[model samples]
Target: MGRNVRKRRSPLAVRAIAASAALAIGGGGLVWANFYASAHEENSSPNTTKAATAQVATISCPDVGQKLTNVPNKARGEVDGELATLDQQITAAYQRLATTRDAQTRDASFVQNAILGPLKNNRSVIIDRIKLEISRVGGNAPSSLDGLSSCTGTPASQTNAGWGNNGQNNGGQNNGGTASPAPSPSASASAGGQQGGGQQTGNGGQAGNGPLAADFVDITKVQANVPRKARTRAGGSTGTFTTSCGVNANKKFNTDNVIVAPGVSNGAHHLHDYVGNQSNDAFANNDTFAAAKTTCANQGDKSTYYWPVVRIQNGTQDFDQNNDGGGKEGNVGQIQQVKQAQIKFVGSAKSQVVAMPKFLRIITGDAKTTTNGLANANAHWSCTGFENKVQLTQQYPICPRGSTVVRTFAFQSCWDGVNIDSANHRTHVAFADAQGNCGNGFKAIPQLTMRLVYGFRAPTLQNGQIKNAYAVDGFPEQLHKAATDHDDFINVFDDNLMNKMVNCINKGQRCK
Candidate 1:
């Protein structure tokens, strides 16, 4: 393996570290450094200071949506609108925080007084509106929601710590008792951008938000961590159903999320690559989906499949760069087209699968996992050739020359057998347990698994500078962490096609 021995950090990384140190000293003492040292004592690399630090990076707010599980259907629309407002509030505050680094360095309390204080007040009012909406519809609103109004600054280290380092120490250098050499500058240049010269500034990449150098790991050094599973039982749904949906080659893109924030444009706060249904948007309804044409080869299936668009931050600007969910919100780059997208439905290991109800909505992974913690985080990033050997949940893999980046998602496979949708947009479907058994009252449904491959040059990290940095579009406050990567699906399969899929799986036959 080639190695780049340059020890100099990038200008942006240097400035971030200096600003963080100044903020730490001006705000209180050396608390930020001490905290980061203690937290990452096991794998403290030379680039530790460049990682997401607490003092200067991004804002952290409580995820209110995750706490609202029982919102009444009658009030769900209003509540979702309020929730989107809350997100907007956080995004605005984060932008302020990013632009006021100098102020934070001068006065530690500037963030608290000028930014977080006003943000808390704004969120409190929004939370109150949500509470009133729920109560007006005869639902019990949780008083504890008031506690979620307050926001805090998150250390970059804490945000990056969502996924532990798979027992490899010092940035995967100690794996197999061999120190993995950094990618050579020439090799890094081949990935995209000029080596070490054309990289973006700020803590992250072009948009200046995130996906820090610490957010990537050398895939070759990772050990095979996928666990072995038992064989399917005698009555297991052993078959598979494949749907050929063209990768968004036509560039169906939007920032709307009809399931979570209906009737609201830019609800997702990030651009999404869409396939399947052609009429999917914030204003789309069940009727709209049913009547929509599909990109899938199967005309009977109009299911909508979408996920956050990945961008190459090599100083390129997309059309949305000037729009709300685009550059104005810190997502700036050229959106990379997905090279391949494989949508497959498979049977459960324990029993024959049942058909998913029409309009059944399912979201795999959490778009706000940075601040929401890992309760619903399900991101799995890997390189094409090394997928079976290793999978990453929090870190983006730095693939070798022959490999490309891959994102895999195994959506929830069990349904409640009642509502096609839920208040929080998650309760209607649940993931099967380790034994492939659904919880009581839930029935087995064909699990949707997506494998999306991007053939862009793999990004390289050298001296704390990420060259040709690429990140998934996400809420501004979420900072484009790999853990925040997510996918959305809404089943619109016709009755006949749905039955065909069920039969194909239950009968242990693979069909397209």
Candidate 2:
């Protein structure tokens, strides 16, 4: 509601309290329990610890320092321009998300403090009245709805865009260039009622990273799981891939298959800028998975499943064939953009990665700013060292010396095993990060993929594209809550205090 100028912070500052202080908002109602009380954090009992240990693994990326050509060509300009576009898209998503949060706040406030009170005293009467109201409102229970198991919510088999195990891939082409109809008022009533009357307590949205949680194979696992024949390009059969990230592998000599060049001087560049780097032989010719692992290892820790990912697409084609449950597909669609790569991380969490690719684009500059990839173009994460370059995803360099670098106050974090509700049946890795905690290395997470798609899709739809399309759809609801909450937190959240909290998570003290 109130306005404040957003600025980027140092990586260390974001990592300082990224674990505990990070707050996420979802439609089931804003509750802090889901973010903090996750499976990864609490290790109270020996039994739980053993169970948790089974889910964690450590792998090495010895190729971390691999060097690639570090040419100073103007192509980097094109990449930066593309990245700027993505930033605009992402910024737009955040804005839309803010709007959704406001609506949700109003909607939720209406439900919790307004509608809920009148129904509290007379339980049976309320249920009867509500049921009648639902019928009158055209949200009647189906003829076959009677005697159904509470879990099934229907008496007989029903057909819909059911979210089964392969829900991710199924939502394909659902974004067919045309703006899908916003749910009708009746449907909205049904969704709202489901959020309210039904067992509003389930794992639907709570699942790790939404839909992609279960199918999320570690980048190390992607590299490790390579079939003997699949690893060799000679087979050229376009080997079958078992992992989700492997969807990008296939037979193409595309960026998914390329590697980061070895050497510290290969100076990190935005994955978006890699096409230019590759043209100059600055991009590594090593295997793609190998480079990803190497980048992960260099960041410290050997856990293959924890590394954060930064994804970018070159156009409007679906880079990832397997959406599973995650509604991330095609180039930048209506609900989400940068599919699988916008994720940024802090601390020693880079080990969980699996695989990623690079994307290329063309960026023509304005009157004064030219798309000339000069060394001093004033790009964020534009430093001489490789370390400086790797942080490109987080920092946005100001184009002109006197102009402002559009900073954003957005953050996303995810953990394994936390479920939102029953209907939201999917493993979820929560998305949490905020400009407020940017100083903790918000820009330090190594980006892994930059893809090229072939069409133009609205980025706003991509951010809010819930798979069910029936229950949870649109950005205005959840995004609004998250932004408002974050804005409030930034205004009041003490940086020093948050730093201490993050230190506790890092030291494993907070979890213990």
Candidate 3:
């Protein structure tokens, strides 16, 4: 099994998601506006006037549209149905956005967003037009059932007398010879301007003016309605791994933990959260992993432990390597390639190594094996200036501070007995056996994910254990030179638990 890593976004990426979400809401409003304009235009025409009369020909039609529910009812269902359909269209737009990461593959998504954003947001625009027409219908009704109010030829019953209001007398005072009297405020709000086959005054606000009462859609509610469309982003924090344990001949852990600056420095940290806050931190990389091997071995368990690495396939978001090109965004395919390389490094492992939740040991194709596919040589050791060497630190009663001293590591030093850098040389540096040189700096950080799970003891035997451990000397050089194979590995962790981990990171708990 593999651990799920939340991808982090650059500030620009965060803005992009916000912008997209805003557009989704805006799209819905536009649809409603279009409908309102069309309705108003139709009402102005002679044919529409007749149709409007037919629609309300019967005074017996119950005044059914009351109380605002998200759903539409029979009396108002036709217009409401159109709004519902518009909601569907907006939902579809979000779905497309979740699936696509870049602008080019998202034509349908863009179209949907652009179309629906304004309509759903402009409900007031709709109400205004409807109110204008409602004013024509008058507010009060006759006490007796009327034949003209019913959609069917028969007269409506007393129960629906409210629908029979002819508005001739009970309606407001007729403005000096105007065709119809103005509607009352309550009537304008509820009935929306339909009385006596006449047009009504504007509702809520003037035409083509003012904001809608329901402009802000409940985003959380929308999320519930469409769970699959939720966005997943990466954590912004970087991880640091600084064990100097003579593993890999005094080289730091072979993993690469990219520090995003201004983040915590626990070594080899992986990004975990993406949607809400875009942040990152560091984690311990080399401690408990090798220790788990020894601890399990002494207990006669054959399980092996290692760290997990990942390549985040950030679906349409752009990428910037070293923040180059002033934050230029790349396409989805290019981002996928970066993610694939990370996966390849994390999933490769020895036969008996069962991947731990957050940690995993990997075996690359370029790894040399003596026989039966055991790790012959690791990529970490080959990158030294000279040949390659691997060495484990002396068994430690306690994990040391800062980088591990090679003398205390479990593996022998892989150093080739040559100092690569005289300025920053240290006694604990391990030399490569093949190249006779100390490992370069790349291997200094342990695998970021594994560092997260260090010291995590399995609660049961069903979970795998670490049997043996090794650190290669020349990681960066050897890692790239080795053959590469890609695996579509499915790795996941419980989101709830992962969330706890995220919280821990935020609170400065490197690995809990």
Candidate 4:
């Protein structure tokens, strides 16, 4: 069990590479600094100061990410389909184990019951079917699940004290009034300024002269009378079911500070928090999950909700470099912790509702994405009413005055009615329309809509100097130029609570 308990660390190069992006949080959002990849010469002399210099970058999975192509349609429908489903389930369990390992108590029980158990069952079924279908067909089957595309944890130990202190130099721009002219969103992403050492960087941090650039767009730009966009409607024969869950705002960020890698190893690559579900983190259990009081308006609901811990990135706040205990007072970065998630549920109107299965898991965006390019970035940034308009240029958005800063999350609501989940953690359910309505042939569950509202705080003044603080903590230094920031939801709901919620959806009642 302790074979992989070692604390993993990111290389000085990777962290240096990520931190090089001095995201211009002010007007125009990102002001990405360039990381120059060091050239490796064959005759280069061995140096004792390797950690301080050029090092080969380490990728998390050298054997994963294989997609079956050109297979016979029969195998595709029979073997490949089952394999894909198993892959999704495995990834979900992996994510749970990863998060659970990082959870406050390192709840091995939940890892066993909620995560590993289901993973084994699903994988076993998949392997048996794959063997039969492949033997029957004339083509080769994938040799292993390792070749599957995955959405679990990265070997964060592949990171380092966040790229390097080069961000400190980029931080100089904040102090200097001659900050480079905020470039057009199009031009801000080129080599971005250069990193001091030979290190490559990702896409994020651009210059914006406007008073509002930030990674997460706040509602500051919100007009008093700006109308909310109506939720998408399919406009079919089915009537829609709705659930407007209140924001458990003011919830506490528990002691779960560090992110664990695939095997549930103690990892320091990024940080996160757990709330709402009292049984979150490593200590999570069905009993605790069922017993834990919820902030949702529904009394008996219990679900483990977690996301990267938010940090006030004033003056290069380090990741939660330290902790007290019990997941309390653990902010080593001296940042503000976000307290709540504003939630809304969208469901299909025509189909009968069904109870949400226990242990349903989904990750909405990729937090481990590199800062390499913007086209593939999914940082999902936008402001209130402007949600449809994604700003890939700015890591964050400066809200218009009078509007609230909002981070939104929408989960797939359509269920396949059989498998509670799929290999992608998404295939089993489908989204309705852009307006949050569901389609036919699937039972409507609450269309999970979550918005995080924040009042941006300027960098804090500390030690006679203003510290540059980020709104969230422990993100991949690059933020994948776009999809670096994301959110997670785990259905740890009590059976009774889930059934009641299901009933509400089936009855087409306005539920809270």
Candidate 3 residue-wise lDDT, 1-512, digit = tens? 21112233344543343344443321111111111111352232110101111111011112111112212112122223222222222333333322232341324334335433343343333333333333344422222212211111111112122221111111111001111122232322222211112232111111111011111111112211101211212421222212111111111121212111111221111111111101112222223222332211122221222222211111112233222110111101111111111111111011111112332222211111111111222222111111112211110111223222111011212222232211111121232222222244312211122111122111111111111111111111011111111111111223443344334433334432
The Cα RMSD in angstroms, rounded to one decimal, for candidate 1 relative to the true structure is 11.3
Candidate 3 lDDT at 27 equals 11
What tens-digit string does per-residue lDDT give for candidate 4 at 183-265? 23333222111111222222211110011122232323322322234343343222233333334354445433111122121
- Greater lDDT among 1 and 3 belongs to 1
**Poorest lDDT segment (10 consecutive residues) of candidate 4:** 22-31
Ten-residue region with minimum lDDT total, candidate 2: 482-491
- The local distance difference test score of model 3 is 0.20
Give the candidate number with the greatest lDDT: 1
User: Global lDDT for candidate 1?
Assistant: 0.69
**Model 3, residue 207: C-alpha shift (Å):** 50
Winner on lDDT between 2 and 3 is 3
Candidate 4 ranges beyond 4 A from true positions: 1-268, 283-288, 291-297, 316-319, 322-334, 349-352, 369-380, 384-394, 433-442, 458-477, 480-482, 506-508
Q: For each predicted model, how many residue pairs clash, with residues at least 3 apart or on different chains?
A: 4, 93, 119, 74
Compared with the true structure, model 2 gives a TM-score of 0.19
**TM-score between candidate 3 and the true structure:** 0.15
Candidate 1 Cα errors over 4 Å, as ranges: 1-58, 160-202
